[model samples]
Target: MDTGPETGTGTSEQTTSQSARPGYKQLLRTADAWTFLLPGFAARQPFAMLTIGIVLLVQHTTGSYGSAGVVSAATGVSMALFAPQSGKLADRFGQGAVLLPGVLVHTAAIAALISLALAHAPLWALLAAAVPAGASVPQVGPMVRSRWAVKLNGSPLMSTAAAFESVTDEFTFVVGPVLATALCTSVHPAAGLVAEAALTLVGGLLFAAQRRTAPVPSRLAGGGTRHASALTVPGVRVLAIVFLGIGSVFGGMQVSLTAFTQAIGEPGINGLLYGTFAAGNMCAGVVCGAIAWKVTPQRRLLVAYPLLTLACSTLWAVHAVPLLGALGLLVGLCIAPSLITGYTLVESLVPAAARTEAFTWLTGAVALGQAAAATVSGQLADRFGASAGFLVPLGGTALALATLLTLRRRLSTTRQDG
Candidate 1:
């Protein structure tokens, strides 16, 4: 039996062979490709910025990185818990119906959180504001992937679409953090959150307006009956765990970089260092998409994940800024392959009806891991130092690697289900 994604096409081997070759130019020219892509990119930029912005503002207000991490973690935790539900609603209803109200709520919630932070309200008040802000985050990334799946369901270009989306995500990370950090440090502590809110409102509206390209609601696609959650699939669970490890790397890096820069008495360089790491991810994504590969996504994922762990292991030992930046770039380079592969595997693992929900579960797991890492790393950095904070990524990825090794067989998708 063929082990590749069942793209609904009978010629799995032929399609898989074609997928290994470059065809991004063809993907770009697909009908209505840019109609949603531009707005979707704009809408998701806040996803990368929100947590870091919260961290900066709260730290500035409270004079405690630990406090900052706790607040941001609350936001991330809420997002993790609620994002999948949002996706489920989108699958049943429509993306526009779900996104419009979500963006509105998110903007108001973020504004409230910023105001309370500036007012020096109690942490409980801030946490209350954070939960809604996070819970209301628009599920743009997963929604966009769902659209791509609709557009190129069984086409060989679907693999390229995954790579392209990964590249787009990395690019947003590259821009979002640098923009947030610059705004926060150079302008005002709350400037980043303000910008994030504005972008979410405007971009979310624009993306929601593009109803022409939106996937048909599963309720409409199928019968009116309810669909099961994506987590029912064992592969989704495994992938979600893998993404959590990746999220820990992101969270640990954010806090540890802040501490490292502040320790050197040049806190402004934190953005540049993080940007360098993000640039590595974007570069790798570009290359990953362009190459033709005969190896399956599962095998590619297994290879890439161990490399990510090995790269992260050295993060705790680096003290010099340049050395740390170099190490960060290396770590970033190892990340895209695993991310791209995991996403590619999802096409074969989950049914089309629950695709959006499956994507959100993986995305939410990242947010959840990032939240946990940010909290622990922040506390460690405050009491111990930045070096201690850096250990979180290594520890998270190592544990995940062990899990992957133990449950490697579960990662395979022998059949696709809806």
Candidate 2:
């Protein structure tokens, strides 16, 4: 298998190609790569909206941030728990087979949750509706990464693909939250979720229809034997844990920023503030992808992870909106390299057949961590104020960094393809 500079295990051919430092234009020109990328981007945008949309709508109805956070946490927890199973099914069958029904169910579920929230139903009823809403979230991001893995396998361009996809994901975050926040604040409290459902329906169907680009099912590809879960891999586990911490930054920021804006009688600024943070991530992704790095992905991750912790440590101390926006941007800037490096590392760490599942495990880890953090941060914000909620990202990253440090050696043992 061809490896890039990331693994430092590439053959001379890989080294020769790596010497030129492939760009995004080269990556996009690869055999209709843009076909799936566009629809996949639309399909995945709803994910960025789900938690924040839930929080916004529920908070508006319940008049309690804690309740809002709990409802959103329910959705996140269900998604994190069920997403891997969805990926496993996609791997065994095909992405289209899994995604078609997943999207339909997700749209219906989101509708139900929105109705339940609008009706001021009991928390139990809302939680019940949220379960399927999240559980059925189409695994578009993971599926897209799997598509790229198939398209660019054994090429130096795989790292470029990884970086590009991370940028796409970050870009969606930039657009999704701002759009959701705008729809909710300007239109109606439930407008964000309404748009989320509509997009999931339209975008999900469009993405699923592009079946030609889908990766081959593992069983059809002659890997019919029962494969263990990707989480069984120690390296995957470590990466998942690290991703969970990264998710905390997202969750904490969403709730804390909202509370901060609300506390200052400027509730509409939530989207702009969050957008600035996500913009930082997108900018860094562009820069990270454009660079021709000599360092291994593992080393890059080590350096980037610490910087994320350091950047997040200061978020709790700032009350000024301008400073908060600037600091949030800095925190955002620190995130993309870690995310890009982690995805790049997946190339050498897992076999081709289980690639989608591996991606989902990391994705699900982010959801789970975000869910837990949203719950904790919401409670903290409700009691102690928005500043207290910011602490979640700092503490979460610190713990994750420590774990990555101790288990750092496991990441070096890449899978040896024969």
Candidate 3:
């Protein structure tokens, strides 16, 4: 049976083999690609902003960093739990049907959260509002990447697209904190959350309207036989576990950096230090995208993972602010490439039907890792000082390296089959 292009994996593969290396200009010009990309970029801005916003709001209203930490943790946990379910829904239904409603609900909940905080609502009420707010956040990152996979599917341009997305992700993380902090401090404590809600709604709606590039629902693609969950796919669980370690590095770095800044009586410079870290990733991602590499994604990860481990290990020994900032930049250089490689591997491992869910699961693993790292590292910093907290990320990177080494054979097999 010859399915139409929308449902035809074979067609995508054929196109990929025949296509030449597409430069950035050529890729950008391909079929409303900017229209498709802009919304995703806008939608993702909130991912960086929300946690900071929540922390600031809670702290401002309640005068308790401990309470703020709990609220932020609750939000992360809710989003991590729900991200895969949201992706599964998008896979089963059309993106528009699933995304638009999810975005709306999530935005509304964020607005309500801001209002509750502003009104000085009961602590429980404020905490309760965060659940729905986080739960409803559309899995925009996964959905957008899925669109790129469908559009660019077997082509080399897919690597470029992934790199571009990684760069944007780095940009969002860098900017989100600065923007959130600026708004919360200079304008009003609620402004950051308000901006997040507005941007999410607008960006999500714009993204959903680009129906032409959205992946076909699994049911429609497969004539209603349920697709296997991405989790069921070989090697996916292992990849998720490795990504968890990677995420722990990120989470631990964040908490440790903040603690370090506070310890040095320069808490305000935390955003600057984070931007330095993200800047390194952004530059590296661009370079990675521009160059054509002969190495497979698995091999690329093997090299990058150890570099990350080395950079993070160095972080544990650095006490001077200037030296630590340079090390942070070095760590950033390793991060984007590793992430891009991971996304590329996920694409190869999972079937088209389960792509979004698989990607979301990877993201969820990172979130869980981050949450765990933050909790543990926070305590370590409190008890033994920020320098001791650096061990959390150092340990995380070491584990990631070990996992990559242990699973290289399985990963190679999956890539070969893919």
Candidate 4:
């Protein structure tokens, strides 16, 4: 079956070029890549919006920050557990097959979560639904990237695609939290969750129906006996560790900000604070996007990681109301680009056959990190205060950078030999 956006093409075709692919800059200006990607970017927004909105809704409902933390943690946990499985499913049948199902499952779960909250159901029940939700969360990032890569034939356009995804993500994050918070604060607290569910389901379906951008199903579902063993591959293993570290930092950043808000006597500003951080990330993404050059993925990471480390660790210097949040904003600017760079590197490093599974591994790593931070960071905040809670993630970020630096020698040598 024709699965990509160009459904009329009848079959998935391999049209890769032996010629040099366009640079990252020119890809953005190119008509084809943008046509495929722009819609994909638009499709991704609702997913982020709902995810953020629902988390806030659940957090507000339970009133126990711990319960809220657990519900949010469930999302990370579910996504971690199912990401590889979901990716494998994507690889096999088609990304569209997996995408729609995941979105539906997620939408249903969100509805259940809202209903559970309204019915005053136990937190335990809500947590159960969250598992399914996480398990089915959208594969948008990986799916879209994979399509772009295949479509663009390994062009520098891939980096531009990565930048586009990151930037779009930042845009979603910025709008998602603000809109979610605003909706939740309204007389109809339930409206936000419903809107999220609807958007996710509709968006997911719309994306799946867009044949131009979907993946061609190879004998993927039943034909190739590919490995869960992809997990065992050396480069993937290394990348997984990097993801784990980075995920911890991202997850920990959220928990820290939440804790920080409370500690500074302005818990109400939490959404706005996150929105600020997202704004900075969005700005960074735009800058990254405008640059048409492709710096080696490793070089980008090497430069970006240290900046992440520095920004994350330095927020403690402020004694002002919004200044701390402002510093946090500064810190977050490079975060999405760094992540985009990392994912781009991962995609470049992994084999095509293993792409979906590889992306899953990254998602799982992220989920694991977020869940752990939510579980631990909160308690740490309870004990030593929010500022101290942050130190753990900052330290983790530094350690991750160190690990990456240590591996740089081997990695650089390997890439050159190839």
Candidate 5:
């Protein structure tokens, strides 16, 4: 029942002990934390690879960006629909019980998709394979965050942990795409997906094996009543919507960048450019986590959302490849701080019983946004060219900003014991 201080109140209660704010060296010394973190981090590598991998693989085989978009979107749609159910199962059972089976099914599905794509199977077959591939994606990120919540509960280190996870996510996105692109372009279009399947199996097993840190199933205090769904939680609903917008920005950027590079005769460089975008987020996330903020998480989000909107809007005008890369880096600056704060707020809002499910809802929103953005952006790129597709992210950013403004008051109610 110990939540940290309410953010953005500008009071001494919001501050933490000096010792709680450990340096990077001291942070790593928490060996048990890393044991839980590393495997999940490895598992996440495939998340970044899958969407782009499908795009590249299908596009190469069918020679149509729209087909590639639909195939990739199918995965997102499946993940979006099924992620919450998986998380709820993890919460009811345990990480290992859910993840082991999930990983097996997910890996097998990805393999099937790869085989189908390599053989130039019908588009419907490829799309059908994507369903189980995505639906069975182990909820690694949410599970890890939930573990952090349990491990760091009632401590100031919660913010630091959130920042670390956010940075880890950015880092994975940075490397995953580059690695996938290299494997696809140099080896074969299916190489990236094959590698993703391998990583999922290895990392999922390693992460699930750490039973000591896994969260115990929730039980009511005085009775055996079940907890309400995370969907019914007020703040969770708001944040999920916001996350949807953020996901759209990311999805649109990825698909548009691919089309742009392909148009400019540098399809191979798409990963590098995407890495540049994530590089900015990684660097900022490191700094954001290290520093103690005086403002509430809501205040930080208010500022960060507008900045993201402005940054994404600028992409609409970017024509030159080098300038676009630079703009991508600039646009990435606010992403980490926003996400770090958003997750922290989500932590404050939901009770421990529904923590994993709540976090998974956030991830589901992102997947939903990605599903919509990939299809829409790809269509725009095909019809109006790549730069024109930037409008999708721009529109998403604007809508996110509006959502925040509308819900600002509700989000500001972040108390330590909510």
Candidate 6:
């Protein structure tokens, strides 16, 4: 059966000799593609919805933004701390092995959280539970990307897959937070919590079930100690810095949205404002996918980084109500394409056995950066001005853009992406 993902037009018999060579359509049309990807899409809906629910639930329950922030930070920190090891594990024992542990841990964490809330446990205990819970982050999207890239014989299907993932990710973030916000405010917040638990269980399980899409373990690790090496590699380092800027812009934007909405006493407006940002990103990513760039991956970054920089920098001027949304939309427009490009490039540059670890490193970097950004942005908004807080991200985005330009010459393409 043909998978839902479409292929280009079929070739004439004259092209029959070329059948030995596979294209993206054929690869994506395979059983492995639909089995992995469709489930992945189904899984994303709740994945995003649950995460946003957790944040909102905890924040509302504790009535302390600091505690909420720490819990949120813990999730990122745990992911950052464990992703490399988890990724390496995926490389060693196949992606499915690590996924089981990750999801169980994640499910337990959410369940533990609900249980603690019912038991009225202290904040410290809550934090303790969260630490273990965060560690269970299933390496879903990255593993799928790597799996598909190999499935497609390393054709440009990788780019298409990345674009497809980006679009879904953007959609998930957009709808997830809004739905979570609504659920948290409704007559029952616990229902949202329960829903989150179910998702982590089902989504995590379905993803792990598709053995065909799991990475084939290598005899030896392609690269040693990705957590250490990702920082050392020039290209990884450059991309890491870009992720830092992305984290700051996104993290600060999140906090700012909440603050602004709460300030106006229409607290739910945060979802609306943030949704616009996601819409911009989705549109931007689709546009990028449509534009076929002959430029090298590194060169693509050269062009994209500046656009991303300008997008974030533009937020500094967002004092006007309409302009605030416009600036956010502009930033969103540039954000996903740049991120998708950078990540796709990273996938190509890193070795196959190390691909999982490499992606984890990238996710961790962005998460860590966002964690730091959230803490700092909260303080800045409290002390100086809410409007002025955007300057920090503006400056950071500029710095990231500069770093990418400086290292553009040394950037390496992932042989797999070739």
User: Which model scores highest in lDDT?
Assistant: 1
The TM-score obtained by model 6 is: 0.85
Per-residue C-alpha lDDT of model 5 across residues 334-417, encoded as one tens digit per residue = 788888888888777777777889889988888888878998998999899988878888898788789888977777455422
Residue pairs clashing, model 2: none
The residue pairs in collision within model 1 are none
Q: Give the TM-score of candidate 5.
A: 0.93
TM-score of every candidate: 0.95, 0.95, 0.90, 0.85, 0.93, 0.85
Q: lDDT per prediction?
A: 0.89, 0.88, 0.78, 0.67, 0.83, 0.66
lDDT of 6 by residue, 1-418 (tens): 1111223322221133135233334435544468888777656566455444555666667764545556666666776677767876776677778877777778888788877755767778777876776677676766777666555434555566677667777787678767667777674655666776677678878988887556666533333333234444567767877887887776667666665666567776667777788789888877666555576667676777788777776675565556787888888887887788877776667666566677777766766666666556555665665565567667777877887777776567634321
- Select the stronger candidate by lDDT from 3 and 5: 5
Better of 2 and 6 by lDDT: 2
The better-scoring model by lDDT among 1 and 2 is 1
TM-score: model 4 vs. ground truth: 0.85
Model 1 Cα lDDT, one tens digit per residue, 1-110: 21112334335434543464457887786667799999999999999899889999999999898999999999999999999999999988989999999999999999
Estimate the lDDT of model 6. Answer: 0.66
Better-scoring candidate (lDDT), 5 or 6: 5
Residue-level lDDT tens digits of model 4 in 12-73? 23233223353445555433555546556656666445545545666567655456667777
Candidate 1: TM-score?
A: 0.95
Q: What are the clash counts of all predictions, listed in order?
A: 0, 0, 0, 9, 3, 2
lDDT for 147 in candidate 1 is 85
lDDT of 5 at 175: 97
TM-score, cand. 2: 0.95
